[model samples]
Target: MPSRSAAGVDRRTFLRYTSAIGVTTAITTGLTACGGPASNGDGAKGSGGSGAGTIEAGLSYALSTGFDPMITSGATPYAANMHIFEGLVDLDPATLVARPTLATEMPKKINATTYRATLRKGATFHDGSAVTAEDVVFSFERVLDPKNASLMAQFVPFIDTVKAVDTGTVEFKLKSPFALFPSRISVVRIVPKKIVEKDVKGFDAEPVGSGPYKFVSAVREDKIVMTKHDKYNGPHPAKAQKMVWRLMSDPSARVSALKSGRVQAIEDVPYIDVKGITGENKVESVQSFGLLFLMFNCKDERFEDKRVRQALHYALDTEKIIETALLGNAAPATGYVPATHPDYRKASTVYSHDLAKAKKLLAEAGAKDLSFTLMLTDTGWVKDVAPLIKESWAAIGVDATLDIAKSAAQYAKVDKGDFHALAAPGDPSVFGNDVDLLMRWFYYGFWPEKRYGWAGSAAYKKTKSLLDQAAGLTDEAKRKELWGQVTDLVADEAALYPVLHRKLPTGWTTDALTGFKPLPTTGLSFIDVGRA
Candidate 1:
């Protein structure tokens, strides 16, 4: 699931490593030459018939991970999971509004700390098993089990126990009053107990769910195939009977595929090509909460002092980078929440570019003559932003050496405390849009406790407490007020702060497909899309 930062682009690593191994040529030879557009595992021609609708699209990312909604983190597979698996309630692909999917309607509140949901009648998994209350209970239990290490568990800390009330009804008992309980049910997707209980690892590779589409076959960095679940009786029925996601990691290749009539839509459209692609193809840059985050190894002596972290944020020319490096396709990260979010609130401690303030803070922290290695991911946009960060720090009398590498490789160093700081793209928007969920993604759980080395600190403990208090509060205004307090403290400390929120650019032939809107998250979604 995206809860684990899956399929989020480590764009440069995917492109570079694939190119080095002749992956581009391999993809071309494997897919293009097999009959026509999409190829099945047996190298057989796809059922791209006229009446039975089919949509072929290019994705900027490769299948670098699994498709399990509980643990999958790669952007490509995360997107695919949306089509194959569904929760009781789901965030609409475009609007982020909570909508009922597996359940007949929103989970009704039985009490302040309990909720009840009745599964939709006749709903069945792709394997043809009935969608029973036992299945729902099993799904939630799997996530709540600490031994499984399911990333989805972090998002639903309010859930104390999920029990089967009847054959079709399920009840959830919460530890406290959670305002977003109804919508938060979307975090734990319902999976068949029989299938998963037998072969958990095999299910991750070839998933079987009760979603609109059924997984067919997947070849990493090549293609992912799916067919419409004819038995699907959901609100958003599959408009296209089949979907072929061609893994085009190269930006130009995705655009070229759209132009050459090979694909009807493409994701991660290059900023440079937004205006250049004309005629039937159109590009739209959807504003997203996806951000380039700046995090420090808080365990390190130099960054242990919050002032050092603040100094780094103050030194960056954020506005200039957004305008120049991002081609004005991003907004300055003024707060934890982006300007586009409905619940947007500007933090009290907004960091503006000020060299004097940065130097002063460094001096106060006893590190005026500072020098450290800045570890960065090699995503295309991150590469563009890296030099600007270096220049900004250098101007303030700080020597920052750039150590650019793949996200996983860089994280290996970060986890082991071998690096000073990190800059990379991340989007927790997939899990939720609320301030609490967003804050928890970085500050709470495994990320801070294990990876960033901030859990033991006083600041982290206070942050966690504030979040817990906010969760228990039934009043909406009070909850937001507490969130604002958290936003202020985190910003003031500047441990893991955002540099900017980027716009996700996507291109589609408007005339060729219907209901194919651009997404604000990492990967593309075609929930109710069909050929025109």
Candidate 2:
């Protein structure tokens, strides 16, 4: 089981809460003024003079998890880790292309199942400890250790062993040949073995990594702060002296923060405000793999039949949800991956809104008078669409009781197999953009095995086999072909499938920040961004 805070929500339930405290802090703190100074007594001092000033930005998600990269799944903390941590290889925050971080370059292939990487010379952690090969091995080992229940463990299942070949060199031996090994290893960030072993809990709260920024302090549903790591010698050095990420879950608060010049950037820009904000700031709605999905509890007898699952999917008027709730900012999901994805291939079964078809499927499955409580997270946009979802199902004579709550509470129920159906947002593209990585995020690992209760089914076995087969193939066409098959299979089954692939709208000021680019996935990245 994944670790949860006292609030019973795992880090994975990112963007799940709208805290009154966050709104109150935004209002009472007087963040409305132009060019407000950094928080009083923030203690963020750095040697990066002149051009480097504090970069204040507004983040939409509350801090629901710790900073530990191995276990964190919260969107805000994950974005914070991007500035605070580094992998042997890391995805470019804006483009998601894998690039060498601690490693000299991408890991060099030694054999079919072996790869080697040498640490960058003079690379040191935030605490000034030298980044060593042993630390790299320790990082991967901890994630691979099943007892740890790392959220990232499912991303790197091919690895068999990782060992320090020398003081500066680390080697990996895979259980099988995996073509994406070099880039895939980006999922595991290197951590100091000595520090982590001494105090894992403290380390999770205040993580120490070799990235360009160092963690400072964080207040749940309030704010998170970081300072530039002056000692960093990596490719993307922190250009700003310090950073303050305000946890503003309210959409209007984020908009007000950006418009009032309190924040240089803000993510998850409410679609309704796009036109209004674009006149004053830079707003871009990039097509992303982030999606609102419909998931069923397969263990529930009413949903055991594939027809029942498909019927629920067919009942959704996804286009209406996109237009009414999202204000034309999202697309109906055509496949497992968004149609904008490079490896996208349309699933054979496309459930365009058909009330009659939904009725027929329910009847065929002997599921008449189908009634179940539909659970959902109270994300701003998700709340706007929840009633529409119920209305759609009602049209097919299926009564749906909407159970809307915070993300943590909902996922707590989900992980315990206590729900009939769930509609929530997910985006694995934050980790990587490849089809294999995205598909495996939901279908292959903890998801099918634990959350959805589909692990023992024959379809689950076949889906896993196809993903494994795709992972090993070096031929691009063959891998894509296999992925397409898996997409079609999952789409037809409709066990856990995306309802719509939403666009990620981000707002930033051109004059206040330089070298800033909106990420296509969830969360904002300020890796190379500097205060103007």
Candidate 3:
């Protein structure tokens, strides 16, 4: 089978494709534990026990997108889907380890290019419909359909077809022998066929799934409410009777909400407020693959030269940026993936802070007195780092005008090929933890093809070839070797590369919640968490 390409998709499709998989942004807050059942301004009661009370959380991202697991890219909705949907296999909220959720166990290998899984008996969707082989087959089919243009399609390009072998068993045929097939399929969450076909738009607005929680209601930029799926017969059942997720994008509001005991937990704890929150609550910062990357428009003459790109990367005082801006909560990008990742391998080309090297590279590329508008998203964290970035570039004789705006606006300029360079936060690790998935998110798909204008470059072709080779290999060591090579190539090219990987800081009241843990990814998860 030939490798999939994004060549034929139109401009509108390209925009939707990029927007549907918009990068997950970082958020932060602080919480104080309440001694008993906590009551919100609305008189909603929250506490911990089986089917006992509500679990109120102050989420950072607004409802920018819908709830469909197939295409929803907004961090808050994606996190909400964790409670409302499940794949044949689902990753543990805390550890990110793939485990059997709707399936009886992990998909069993039938051959080099085929695998089969049996549904867990008695598992039913939140709407009281039994989850069957048809549902699983339909779920994968919609995502695999090119006409549907699912963002998830890019991740599972190896899949040839999916069929229901029986009412309870589903089979998958891959075009190539993929070693990570079991865990990789976790990207496509299973949804009921009849309801989706009847009303996809309605389904997108309000989702239904076989997880521990059922979608109740969602108001954009306000709150999302859900009730426990009492019929859920899965391993991780909802511990709280109800859940109220208050969408508080303002860091101060989230902090105040948590501190006042209106919410039990909050994520994306502000780096500056970490110390203050730590004195009264449990604040844990987990190093994640989430990163602030610098992307160059390879189509632009000034940035088309790889040396110019490399020079810009070398110019940044990453240590100072992390120390002053992030409060030392991030690590400089040594590789495409974070050092904490299991499959992480040091890239051959590590860009250390060297002003002299940066200047030399600029001169070699004939980019003397370089001036460009550095576009960036107005995410709170990104805004904090914006001036520092300009200062770093200024030291190397580069006049960088910072153009800061919301993610949508900045990305609009990027999508139209109207921008020079952009520094933005992205975390694709929320989908899966494998190196292939992580690297492919930025390097392989619509990102390089449309957003960054590297699709026509020889380096992009080389990176694609290496990734495709790695995907087809069954041998673990050989696959990783190929991945390492791709990592080194991208790092050296520096077309669109990570500047630093951030530590996802989360704050929660220790005595207010049980079985709660911080995620390394962008969103919060309450899979097995309960209010106390």
Q: Which ten residues in a row have the lowest lDDT in candidate 1?
A: 26-35
Model 1 scores a TM of: 0.91
Writing each residue's lDDT as its tens digit, candidate 1 over 260-362 gives: 8888889888888899999999999999988988888888898999998998899999989988888899998888988878777799988899889988998
Compared with the true structure, all predictions reach lDDT values of: 0.80, 0.82, 0.82
Error of 1 at 503 (Å): 0.8
Lowest-lDDT window of 10 residues in candidate 3?
Answer: 1-10
lDDT of 3 by residue, 1-532 (tens): 0001111122244346535434222121221111113223342445556755778898887766567788766677778999999999999878889999999899999999999999999999877889999999999998988767686888899999999999999999999888899998999999999988987766777688999988877877788877788889989998887788998888888888778888888988899888887545788999987888999999999999999999999999999999999999999999999888889999999999999999999999999889999987777878899999999999999999999976667777787999999998877777788999888888986789988899998888999999888888888899999999999999999998999998988988887778889988776888888767
Question: Which of candidates 2 and 3 reaches a greater TM-score?
Answer: 3
TM-score of 2: 0.90
TM-score of 3: 0.92
